[model samples]
Target: MRRIRIKLNRIPSLPERRRVGRKIMADLGIKLQMGWNPFTENIAPKAYALMFETLDKFLAVKTKDNRPDTVRGYTSYVKLFKKWLLEHGFDETSYVCSFTESDAIDFMDDRDLAVSARTFNNSILFFRVLFNWMIERKYIKDNPFMAVKRKPKRLTQKIRRLFTPEEFNELIIWLEANNVPYLVMALMCYCCFIRPKELSMLRCRDIDLDNQLIRISASIAKNEKDYTRTIPDSMMKYVRKLDLSNPGHYLFGDHPMYDFSPGTKKASSRRFASYWSYVVRPALGFPKELQFYSLKDTGITNMVNSGVPLTSVQQQADHSSLAITSIYIGKTDRASEALKAVDIID
Candidate 1:
């Protein structure tokens, strides 16, 4: 075996040295002509390194811009992709540039079997962003994900089970008896038609008690649109009773079970969901699917059943269209009775 030696006049920077080494290896036929380097075969492929480096930069920018959810979501998708690759016998040294449309399809197919349609769609979206970024940086000649098509999402009719007035009253009693710190949050969701995540983002300043209104900033809103909703008279009573010494404090400030640092303005929805799953649900005997979101459904349905106009319900629910709000208004025995009453004999 003959070892080829090359001497340079001066040492270059680490990045420059890597480039020089790759070129030298290529000239000697010791490396592949592809984007990957066989000389660094023990280490991960250059494509993987570039992909991860770009991901790191992307996540840093997103975090600095106060988009923590985006950071978390992108990180999750990359991790899932890496895991899928490893499961299919591709290790760390596998060339990410070798990723093809078929590879992406296989990953999606595998994911579809294990997760929901919405989750699979989210995974595809993440890949689209990642590969597009890679293409922009010349990490790859083309975006492989662009060639992959998402599976058609099944049109499953959403059946939102709303809490009856009796059930809601019983839940309130249970919450009070248990001294649940999330009682205010539950009340806001049920009365104001606020999503759990939106409720968690509320601060004292966002609430105008005198005017009986709550403002949801664009950053916190799901649609990224700033909107204000009038507080229900019942909810206003609870707001008045709350301690508002600090106008900047979180509306539902941290509890032992679900809390952030004193200076933190918002709580994590995952933490809130954990509290609901482990503590609240078991105590109330609620089913697994009857989550915190059910409160919002219960509130909107209650209003519509009580004869609130469809347009009013749409505004209250922050739905973009009345068609969306109509889904929440489920049929009731009272509705059946009304139909019977309106029926005329021939």
Candidate 2:
């Protein structure tokens, strides 16, 4: 028998190689389905049709658990990631299971370069939750995002400054004079230590003016924990005077001044921010770093300075820990005065 020798020329092109590899893999998969265990091969892992499918399921579960804000955040982050993946040559058919730690790291690094530290850290956290969900459901063997770390935020003594009594009065006067619908919200935040979003989402029935208490429902609370806040005397009369013909109506529903339609629709965080940017900020003479959130800090800080125990102030603010409440206190003259009262030589 004569043995024929074959001569090898140039190797196949990259695309040709890929096509050949895919054909081989497909044949292997078909054979495995037929129970032909060649070389005792491991079964191929199932992959999602698209990244969005996994995201949709994750969001559904989060929503069912009453974590709307978390759902919104995760959705936004995943959408951004999807867009980034597409821009970088990934397509809808790409398996989410194929995503690697390097991919997550690259995404985080790119985002960190383009955004603030807080935003960058938020993206990291979002991906951590996302991949953990994938792993829990056996969609992936491991979380690729586990390797990513959050960027530490710089500690600022005054992250947001507490409003002085004069500044608070000026704000109230401006809101009243301009007929801004957020006047009630501002007062609620300043006096009752209610978060803007919680106050905005309050219903007529949420308030018990007779008892001088406002109940923040778990659905609207930031921490998803319901708590009652005592309504300050200054805001009691105002709360009682609100039109409660519809018990289900939003306490701070739409207003013509704020360009919102009057209805049961809850006031959005965006609308509140817009109101601050265009109206409140300018009206307050553009006070340095002053924001609507300052109302909560101002209220809590005032309580602390007015001889209210830190524990009491923490409870009123609904803070999970005293450490969180301390951040709002900043450096008050009252604290200095109290410290000055210590006579070492007396």
Q: Against the hidden reference, what TM-scores do the models get?
A: 0.75, 0.78
Q: Each candidate's lDDT (Cα)?
A: 0.69, 0.71
The digit string of per-residue lDDT tens for model 2 on 1-346 reads 4332211122246774465456546855896799985445322243332465567777778778756666677678768888998887676545564577888888888897898777777677778877787777766767777888766557214456767778888887887666545677777788778876676688888878778888888888888788998887877655555666677888777655684322587777678878888877886796757888888777777787677788988888788899987775645644476567888895
Q: For model 2, what is the alpha-carbon lDDT of residue 93?
A: 46
Tell me how far candidate 1 lies from the true structure as C-alpha RMSD in angstroms.
6.6
Q: Model 1: per-residue lDDT, tens digit, 98-198?
A: 57778878888888789876766777888888777676665565666776666576633344466666767877888766644466678778877887777
State the displacement of the C-alpha of residue 329, model 2, in Å, after optimal TM-score superposition.
Answer: 5.6
Query: Model 1: residues >4 Å from true position, as ranges?
Result: 1-49, 57-66, 83-96, 135-143, 146-152, 155-160, 257-266, 330-335
